[model samples]
Target: MPLNSFKSKDNNAKPNRRDSHESTTRRVGVNPTLCRYGGDCRTKGCTFTHVNPPKDGTTKTSDCKYDVNCTRLGCHFNHPNGRLIDQKMVSLPDANQQNTASSRVVSQSPHLEKRAHQRHQQLSESELIEIIDQFLSKVEEFDTNDQESNNSDNEQVLDILEQNALQELRLQKFEFQSAINHLTAEYNSILSSTTDKKYNLLQLRRIKQKLERELKHWESRLPIYARRSDIIEKLEKNQVLILKADTGSGKSTQTVQYICDAHFIDEKQIICTQPRKLAARSLAARVAEEYGCEIGEEVS
Candidate 1:
């Protein structure tokens, strides 16, 4: 039964009735407008209580928005008495429950599992930058080459995610270098062989077609390509060549390759230095890939 309905037979029960009333009554000093429904307020109603009782000796409960149109008649939001918690606030389980649910989902998802594995071996800043640089170079190259083709809309779309991965980046680099090596090998084979030695015309034509297609597919019209001759001439005449070019200008990879092609073809080693160890390692790895040799062999 409700405390208000209780009746004592004893005449001296005024003090007991006052104590019961005081214990049950919610204080009114707290501002209703300032109360944020951050806890179990949605399902369990407002849990906040006033800091002090009102001077008029009446417990004034605010009109809860959740109370109106409440489907469940017995829910705490539907009644004034059920609005405030007696003691400490009731802790909600939503965040912990959501985290547990998400953990389960990640464990079940193969893609997320792969990402978790990658997270353990996150790409170093330098390596990630190198991947991005190479990927952007490829993109720029494609965009430039695409200008000659009339298919503006049908231009090949490059995905950064595929190219920026360490494994995929290395694989793609190796494949590109392999293609270059194959072309060089074909040229060398044709050159070293005697003029009388008969070559298959169909095979030679196929090789030429393949080389052209590869060139058209990957090679971008870049600043390096345009100024390559000028740079080479300057380097040959001058001891130090200082190139002032922006990132993705193709200087990092192209300059070394140009030097190797022009000056260091036979004897002297071309040494490239970077500020950071990671940068040096990344640059070396890229140069090695470009030269179609192992990292320590032609690069280091």
Candidate 2:
């Protein structure tokens, strides 16, 4: 017996598991001794701020009233059933065995699980209909529930649906009103800016027009002299002209008319001019075509 006691004490002194039992917590997936900045859950009020993270990393992460794995001094409690959340928080399936539960939202999921989640996410209409469907099913299954039960059940479903539909309509109306308000504000801002700029531009244009009109008045009275049709032709043939005319002068237009009239007598008139048609007979065809188009008159 003495020999066995000695051997057990020697085994107990052999290190490892004893060192593990008394250690405090650290943040998930971090070593406490290596971290200089104190990697604890002081900011978030977490339970596992003192215990070493599990080696396999399958530790449950929950903010709950009852938590067994929580190493916090006060409330490291464990629920009789594993989940701290109740059945109503999830859509529980009503079956013979009542143990089936919906797990909390988690990152990891398989194809069937993801499809189920997608169905749940898009569930506003479905959840409402399901209550009525369940009532009908219950009525069919139970013979004891009578006319009063049916009436009450139907009314309850009706009230629920009416409230839901109204809520949805109100949400849609609010969204529309917000959109209209935003668009109206944007339009009014744009209109005011354009109005201010337009007035400034109009003032500039009026100033320019007034200066141009005054310059024209001064120009009209000055008489240096323009040649007649024959004289202009003679000047062109001799390659010379002497001219001064009113700013409102047909002087520029008359030079071209002189050239055109001279053509009637000159014959073989090479109506040579600028990039513009500088003589009348030269412009006649294009003018006639435009006139025809304007009045819907056909031209061959």
| lDDT of every model, 2 decimals | 0.45, 0.35
lDDT over C-alpha atoms for residue 184 of model 1: 55
Question: For each candidate, how many residue pairs have backbone atoms clashing (under 3 Å)?
Answer: 1, 4
Residue runs of model 1 more than 4 Å from their true location after superposition: 1-192, 195-221
TM-score per candidate, in order? 0.33, 0.15
lDDT of 2 by residue, 154-204 (tens): 434566545554444334334334433443354334434545654534333
Q: How many clashes does the backbone of model 1 have?
A: 1
List clashing residue pairs in candidate 2. Answer: 24-50, 25-50, 25-51, 67-77
Indicate the worst ten consecutive residues by lDDT in candidate 1: 34-43
Question: Roughly what TM-score does model 2 have, to 2 decimal places?
Answer: 0.15
Candidate 1's residue-wise lDDT over 63-181, tens digit each?
43323322221222224433232111223233344333223222344455446434423544344335434544564575465445434433245344322333332343444455556
Best by lDDT: 1
